[model samples]
Target: MVASQLGADGYDHTLGDFTAAAFTARAREEAGWLERLSTLEAATPDDAIDRDLVLSQLRGWVALASWPDWRRDPAVYLSAVFTSLFNPFQQRLKPEPELVAAAVSRLAEVPGVLAACRANLDPDLAAPLLVRRGLDQARTGRRFLTRTVPSMVRDPALSARLAEAAEPAARAFDELVAFLEGFACGGDWRMGERLYSTLLRERELLGYGAAELHEKGGAAWASLDERMREVARRAGGTADWRAVMESLMDDHPPTLEAMRAEYEAETRRVREFVRSRDLVTFPEGEKCLVLPSAEYTRPVAAVAHYLAPPPLTSSRTGVFFVPFTPDDFTEEEVRQRLRTNSRAQMPSIAAHETYPGHHWHLSHMAGNPRTVRKVFRTPYFSEGWALYVEKLLHEQGYFDTPATELAHLDCRVFRAARIVVDTALHCDDMSIEQAETFMATKASLTPGTARAEVSRYCAWPTQAPSYLTGALEIDRIRQAYQGSLKAFHDRIAGAGGLPLGLAERAVSRPGEGTPAG
Candidate 1:
């Protein structure tokens, strides 16, 4: 619930409540989770599996509970709130009556949530970038509520309510902008060592500090670079993997329609491969679709993206958002977008977003009887599990050609670079421009791609690194367990989406209810 209010993803919040009072109200509710965490941490459970699961989830709640304080700066809080507010309206979901009611209820609070934005935010503490992004999102959100939402509801009364709310929402955004202009933003966005360590312990249920993560991220970058050289040699190219990567971009599907078809086809192959190898169970009736990116979201989703179903909301299906390059884009922009999303890159991205990855992870997580388990997953578990599947597919001979195989490795390298830069950016170890330049040079990301990715890392701290940190952790657990690869994956799934520490305990122990299928 707190995650939803803060605009963090992965929580299936049924209620559409986002009023200013809701933040205070949710903070009060955190006392229970914090008390529970205290109790569980004090007494060791007789059942080892139960002990870890209880403590891990309780810790996640506590971390989420602290976000309001962590983001007291008006600009930061507004960005997340607006982003969260825009989610339901932006994506497609099942048109159930309850969901419709939820939407209506959320609409009622839009004005209040914005009002809270006015009262609680201290403008002077905000970062300039956050202020800028918040304004961009605010305009986008205003447009959404004013122009886009009325058509979706189809309720005369509700549509009227939305119309009434739009003005205050617009006014609130203007108020924020005016307030921010009064003072210079000097707030530190860095998590630093102490706070970063505390969050790592609470949110991810891990004990490692920023320094350890730095070391891990550094090693990953080195390992990936070494492998990229090997692939370059195999491709009969110079050691300049960047040149090879550039060459591959020219081989992309010629049109957006063709790109969509390619994704649809590749996703089919991914699912089939998962089933053929019995990598994981594929429940019937669950479907995955590939479609064009919505205009509002194109700036964020550079290539393709997958909207995983809400675990709590059963009506939704996974939809992959492929880039919809607008007609006004110069010919070069279209070419570059297609090139980055080339044939070699499609399979790995498909595997990461869909089968045995996000969609699959969410499906099983939604079924957990415990509400906390479903709602409180960390990005480490989610992203790590996805990247873990990439390596798993590679080991299983999933990629077709040497070119595609190299593409898989390049994806790994990109994630490793993310780990390195995310830590530096968050720790204030490097400036934003330095982070952008480093990624471009180290990982071969285009200058434009680096900027977009760095901007994203700024918005979401601790997430980009999760790809490498998470995948490496899952692989470590897999090696420890003496079982088949499918069995290892099944155990992790059966345990629900948990931090790797808890997942290892669940997977390693066989007799518990959360055993591998």
Candidate 2:
């Protein structure tokens, strides 16, 4: 519906497939669907437990039409939207001529979508923190269209046509920039506690309020710090974590190529560990590999990202994109990225992004032939599972070395800090600069990367807390399961990629539906 109505250059990143007309008739269509859902619910109210999440997800789509969040710097939303190319976002699709043509149609529609944004968006709400970056994204989109997308087209005429379309798209970007000028202060995008609570209760069915999550975040941060000091004691004598952390940075692979090589080798090492430990069941014949972030994805995906197999599509393999191209980056920039790619960071990150982490979870989810499980995706369950796997691996001794151990603990600290930053930013207590400083100071992020992360948090107000929040919910379910570790993991896998609340419901009532908290 987002693809059909507002196009890909808008708020929600998950919904685009093929862009269509800017002004769509989907609003009334959604209303009809909502009416049907109401009728179905009234007739069989007992089905609420089973259909609760599906209904909520559908309602979210409906609510997205009127979402006030988009009013605040629609261009920033476009930044997220326009950042990835259409083909690779549809990377799993076979490159049949017709399919390519369809993708090209969508790619060519970038200008029309920007025009729609210019026509409809409220510039007063544009995020000050994001307008420059957002317009940068528009500028990049023109490059992508003229250079990237056209290069992919097989037919000469179509390629020429795509290149020709870039000019209007570039002009639309100017229009968007002009529209964005109305907001002298663009960072005013705040999801206050009231609406934040509403989204938690209704859209996510998450039980905790923002304040409570903030408290949990603070506690988690403190606990992880204590654990880090303990590990630091074991590693050396002192708990001066900065010294130890800096030492670990010096132990990484020299160049980005070497870094990628090490990561790929570590991928195998990680897969072996999961197999040897029997921590979780590894899927058969499913492939995952480390690759550079695509040109368009680099602006937003500064660290790493996992691209799941396209659902209900012919694509089965998943791509794990890590930002590690040293050529385009300077020596100092590369060194800072290497600090993130330190000996401590690599294997721990591998455990989270691959093996029993995102790649592992997604491969298993895709192999499952359940329609409902394949659909209705949520970030809480997905990120939570990855973060939980990080801790799970640590507890199982997957991270056995002192530096790896410290890195694992540090990852937790970062997740915990996100809860604080995400909550405080939305509640109006924390500014973006403050959040960046806090994250960089507490989580060991460089200033630049921290700023990028905080910008994303501003763009996506309530999303940052999901990593720890989802993990906490999963841990609760684990304690309640009374089963072996493998069994507990199997239960989570069976629940599929659902919200934690629904996943809990699934565990509580097995064979009912996929659930998340």
Specify the highest-TM-score model's number.
2
Each model's C-alpha lDDT?
0.68, 0.69
Off by over 4 Å in 1: 1-25, 28-32, 41-54, 57-104, 150-184, 255-258, 301-303, 323-334, 511-516
Clashing residue pairs for model 1? none
lDDT value, candidate 1, whole model: 0.68
Off by over 4 Å in 2: 1-50, 58-67, 75-84, 88-92, 150-187, 324-329, 512-517
Q: Cα deviation of 271 in candidate 2 (Å)?
A: 1.5
Question: What are the per-residue Cα lDDT tens digits for candidate 2 across 118-219?
Answer: 655555555566565565455455566677766767678766865775566656666766765553653466768876766666667787678888899999
Model 1 Cα lDDT, one tens digit per residue, 310-331: 5555533677778766445677
TM-score of each: 0.85, 0.86
